[model samples]
Target: MTDGMTYRERARTAAHPTGRVASSPVVRHALGRAHGAVPDPVTVFDDETPAVANLDPELLRALRRAATDAADDGVEFFVNGGWRSPEYQEQLLRGAVSKYGSEEEAARWVATPETSAHVLGDAVDIGRLDARAWLSEHGARYGLCQIYRNEPWHYELRPDAVENGCPPMYPDPSHDPRMRR
Candidate 1:
C-alpha cells in the first residue's frame, strides 16, 4: 500500500520525468513539499522595465508590447505568475481543490500539472483591474489571448490573433479538453 519514495518524491515522479525534475534544483528546492522555500515572485514587468525571465521568451515580446500599450492607456499590467514547475502546479491544484471543495469545481479553475500551459512556460496570470479590462479589448492585437472566460487574468500568445483575432474563449479550464488528463 506504499511506495518506498516519500510523498515529495512520489509527487515529483508523477508530475514529470524524474531525470528532468532532478536537473532543475531551483525548481526542486523551490517547489518540493519538504521544507520547500517559495521563491520570490520574478518581476516580468514593472513601471520602469519590461523584463520577462524564466517564462516563455517568445510570448514575452508580444506581452511587453501589449503591456506598454496598456500603460499608454493609463492601465498598468502586472504579471502575477508565469512558468511554474509541475510540482508547483500540482501544489496549486491541491490548494484550489481544497478551497473549492470538489475536484469538478476545482477543475474549472485549475488544470492538472501535466496539462498546464504554465508548466510549459506558455501562459501568464496578469493582475490589475484596469489592465485586465484593457487587455480584453486590445490584447488580440499583440497575439495575447484570454483562453478562459472565467479566468480573465490568464492569457497566452496566439500568433494568429494578431491578424485574425483570438478565437472564442472556453467557458473555463474544465471546458477545455486539453485539461482532461
Candidate 2:
C-alpha cells in the first residue's frame, strides 16, 4: 500500500524543487566545466538537464535490455532517477539541517553527495505496485535495488544488490535521543 511521496512523508517540510532554474543560460555555461557561476544557489537533480542528467550509454543499453526482459515477463518498470550534483545535494542537506539539526542527523534520512550512487550516473530507482510484483522478483536481473533504511522509493546498484544496487538531500540522524533509535 504505497502512496505517492512516500519519502516526502518523512520530511516535515518540502525539499526545494530541482528544475527551478530549468534551462537557464548560467547552467549551460558551466556544465561539464569544473568551475563556473550558477544562476541559482540550488544544485539541480538528475534529469534536470538533458545533457548533464543523461546516463552512460552502455549502462542504459543494459537497462533497456533488462526492461525488455521484464516486459516480456509482464512487468512494467522504468528508470526513475539519474544524476545529481553536489550543490543540489548540499541544498537538500541544508533543508534537512533546517528541519533536523546536524550533518550527521541528515544521513539517517538522506545520503551525502560523496557517497551517493546517483552522482556516479549509473544508479536508478525502479518500482512497481502491481500484484504480480515484477520488480521484487525481476529487478535484480537489471541491476537495481532499494537503498537506505528510510526511503523505499530510493534505489541503486551495489555489487551486492544490483541484479545488482539522492542528492545527499535530507538531514543526517541527530545526536539527540529523540531523533535516534
Candidate 3:
C-alpha cells in the first residue's frame, strides 16, 4: 500500500469528513470550481463527444497513452462516465434499485455513493462495444483492469497489473466485500 494506506482508506479520506464531497464548497474550490478555473484537465476525443475529466492524475495519463495506442489499432476509447459527484452516484444507485427491483440486484450495478470508485475518481465506465473489447484484451498493458465480471465496461487503474496482470474479477459489486455496508 502507498503511504501505509490501502486504496479504500485513501478514497474514504479523500471525501469530506461528513462523507459528502459534492456539498463541500472548500473541496469544490480546491477542485477548481470557485474561481472558474479548469477543475481538471479533460481529454476530448472529438468535438462531438464530451470530455473525460477528474480522473486520478496518473490514471488519466495512462488512459490517454492507452487510447493513443488503441487508436493505432483502429479502435478508439470512449469514456461513458468518470469522477461522478456523490449525489450523482446516489441518483444512479436509486435508479438502479428501481430498475433492478431490489437492493441486492442494484448493488450489482451501482455502488453506494460514498463508497463508489467513481466518487473517488478511481474508476471509469467506457462506452462502445469495440472499445470495451479492445480494453479487455489490452488494458493490462496500461495498468487498467476490469474489476467486476458483470460490468464489462467498468475499469480501474491497477498499476501492479502492468507486471502481474489484474487480480481476479469479483463476481459483481454485491460479491465484493468492499460493497458491504
TM-score against truth, every candidate: 0.73, 0.50, 0.73
- Model 2, 1-181: lDDT tens digits are 0334322221211221321222223232224422211233211122244323344443444444444455455544433344456565566668887777876666675456566545555545444454125544554554544444355545444334442231122222232232333
For model 1, residues 1-181, the per-residue Cα lDDT tens digits are 0547543333333233221221221221133322221243322342111112444655766776665555556665667777666777788899999999998999999888899888776888887778788988998998999999999989999999989999999999999878876
Q: Which pairs clash in the backbone of model 3?
A: none
Candidate 2: list runs displaced more than 4 Å.
1-53, 73-75, 78-80, 127-133, 158-181
All candidates: CA RMSD (Å):
13.4, 13.0, 12.1
Candidate 1's C-alpha lDDT?
0.67
How would you order the candidates by lDDT, starting with the best? 3, 1, 2
Candidate 1 TM-score, C-alpha based: 0.73
- lDDT by residue (tens digit), candidate 3, 1-181: 4368643343334333342332112221123222121233322232112224466655655666667667667766667676666666787889999999998889988999767887777887887888789889999998999999999988999999999998999989888887765
Candidate 3 weakest lDDT stretch, 10 residues: 21-30
lDDT over C-alpha atoms for residue 129 of model 1? 76
lDDT of each: 0.67, 0.42, 0.67
Q: Which regions of candidate 1 fall more than 4 Å away from where they truly are?
A: 1-43, 46-52
